[model samples]
Target: MKYRSESILLLACAALASACGGPDGDNSEAPSPEAAEQDAAGPASNDMPDTAPAETGEASGDHEEADDDHAHEAAEGGRLESHEHGHAMLAVTLQDSMLSVSFEAPLSSLGAPEDPQNAEDEARIEAMLEDFRNDETIISLQGDAGCEIVSTSTGTRLVSGHGEMQLDYDFDCENAGGLEGVRFGGFDQYPALLSIEAVFVSDTQQMATELSAASPELKIQ
Candidate 1:
């Protein structure tokens, strides 16, 4: 069952750059048939655990505050760059009812084609992009947090033929004040995704944590 789930995720992320032997040799895209099936199975929420809220202490306060400042500075100015293939970075900023999350990963990790020449290849690439921005399933909130995506902006930045893409997702959670836990839904949709170095900033809290396939939850106090 675990293997099955990961397989579904592999299809969901569409990282099969070497297997996409569709018409015209489109190796950097997901096969249409499997992608359609995966789309059908998605949109169903999972039962992820809600961890206890983050802990704060007198000794950790000053250090956590410093880290929080650095996190916000990084997110606001620009994204965190990563050259590693399997590792990605995520930054989340929460203020009042508005929450912003950013996902940055190597384009090669998704098996990006140098350029699409035909309609078929374009469609396949679009499908892969849509899967990457799975929206509701990309990141989820625990309990009745009422976190819903309000806007999304995606783009690619290339430097010397190597590029990375980032997704900026904005959300409005009605119960924003009760923010406690977050789940990286992309984990269940991308098997190749190893770990995400996540930094979160909130009005009264700031924290950094590493999220892995073995543990994909983030506690936001």
Candidate 2:
């Protein structure tokens, strides 16, 4: 009887050991193919560096374009509008021998010059106009020949002439008093009343003509 009990105890121990070591005993599942693949692919937190110079170049180009557009809009009075081409309007009326001159630029049509040199040129022209307005000689001409600036703005100038002959210049006519007309002597001659118009396009001769016309006989000293 002692030998039989010992045998039964050994058998029970063997069965418990087999059950613990069985394939389905632990209740754990094997890794799926997809999970294995993701592990092999590396961690989700890693970021790779960009390798293409072309992509960098494209990004730079886009930035430059945006900057250019911004500059153009800013220079163009804060908006984009269609420009009128090739014509300045001026209104000329004769009251006496003295000629009153009024002038203006088409702000809507005036574009920001693309080249820096060209921009400087435009600025010089603008300065010349301002100088003319403040010139004692030019003012004297209006008194002698009879003309004066009554009012002025970026887009317009009003002048009244009074001398031997009263001449009024209301240069608000189309294609008669623009930058082009102010720079070129295309419309500098007008009988008893001096109807002068100049266009501002590369030539300085218009400035000379304008000074001469302003005071027909004033010396440029």
Candidate 3:
């Protein structure tokens, strides 16, 4: 099912697309997940300003609500919700100790057959799903957070002439406040995926950025 209510990724993408022409980065420095994890045992420092550059610039109040509504509407039945070659979106939400991450991409981007008419196709999709669930694939967290996967679900939908794949993961962290950032590891597995518009939301604020294989971490502050 589409996570319309909980996700602002579509809106983030729309805002970035309008602001930067597309969900593309500006050669900003991406966070190093390895470094963050290495310092996971250090004292928590929540005051560090967000360093991950936002592709959408700053949010203008006048356009926020309208863009959000448009995004939700687009997600319902518009072309924006469908698969786009070489592009995908990742939404990350953190509420208290519960963290939810959802990814949506084109079937072809994940190397899955457009139409799974046989057992081989089904197996291939299942294998892809398995890869997605691996902790080293989609995202990696600060080890000090003590995060563990609580559940996972995968779904597919026909959109236009192609198929779209959705993967959802839920995690419970023992030290939620210690989470410093998330590093995506799927790019190496799917090199054809050109861009991933990633959005992170927490109780205090939200941030958006574009991720690619060359730079794949989203630092939280």
Name the candidate that leads on TM-score. Answer: 3
lDDT digits (tens) for residues 1-221 of candidate 3? 22232234434333223222324544343224222322332344221000111111111111011133544444434333334677777777777788766677877777787667778987886677556554353656644677777766666655333566766667787887888877777787787787776777765557777778987877775
Model 1 quality (TM-score) = 0.56
Candidate 1, 86-194: lDDT as tens digits: 6666666677787766566655455554244467745654555666544445566656667766666665554433345566666788888777767776665566767
Q: Write the per-residue lDDT of candidate 2 for residues 69-162, one digit (tens) a residue.
A: 5544344321111112222222222222222232322222123221223567456434433433333332222112222333332312111110
C-alpha lDDT score of every prediction, in listed order = 0.51, 0.24, 0.56
Query: In model 3, what is the error at residue 154, expressed in angstroms?
Result: 1.8
Query: Residue pairs in steric clash, candidate 3?
Result: none
User: Residue 111 deviation, candidate 3, in Å?
Assistant: 1.5
- The worst-scoring run of ten residues by lDDT in candidate 3 lies at 47-56
Off by over 4 Å in 2: 1-91, 94-100, 103-119, 139-149, 154-221
Question: What total of clashing residue pairs does each candidate reach?
Answer: 0, 29, 0
